[model samples]
Target: MTASEPGTPRTGPHRAELDLDGVRDEPTFLDRCARDLALPQWFGHNWDALDDCLRDLSWWGRPSGYEIRIRGWQRFRAAAPETARTAADVLADAIEYWAPRDTPLTVTFDDQE
Candidate 1:
């Protein structure tokens, strides 16, 4: 469940962080994700769109290997628990879509406040 301990990076998967603090809503959450993930200009800012960009990772110019570590999620959850839960589910589905390809993208969520 944790992605690479806390502060160290091995010469393995490319790592990214998405901070969920103050993300209380879908639009802001998507915006933060796009900024953090370096998503494309044509990013639709929706669940399916996020899935597509995450699967491709073409915008960031990094391919195949990625570990997206999400933090501060409890702040968002405290503000809107349902929204946070739904977003997590959507992202998990996206990761699942790419996993079987052998170019698996891992998304690990930290619920600590």
Candidate 2:
């Protein structure tokens, strides 16, 4: 059964309610990257660094047609020692900036289930 089917226990904590209409028509991975880059400089500027950290731990990305969800704390701790603390702090701040005080921002795939 589908995730929305009645009695299907939710597998994840936060539900990312993505509205395709709200997403761009010409959506692509690059478009998503660009939008992510528009976040606060502190967080956006470190995207590559954060990605490298996650890559090193085999935590980022997935095979085509699949989706992956990463925990912020896990990614934070995986960063290089010198940058880990700062990365975690910046991530916390960015999360607060992007989400409402009552709700959290949960990243999810836009093009796949």
TM-score of each: 0.77, 0.27
Candidate 1 Cα outliers beyond 4 Å, as residue runs: 1-11, 62-64, 111-113
Choose the strongest candidate by TM-score. Answer: 1
lDDT of the candidates, in the order given: 0.76, 0.34
TM-score of candidate 1 relative to the true fold: 0.77
Clashing pairs in 2: none
lDDT of 1 at 41: 91
In terms of lDDT, the best-performing candidate is 1
Model 2 lowest lDDT segment of ten: 57-66
Q: What is candidate 1's lDDT per residue for 1-113, written digit by digit as tens?
A: 42234554434466889988778898999999889877889899998897778767644433336789999887888888887887888778878876775446788888666
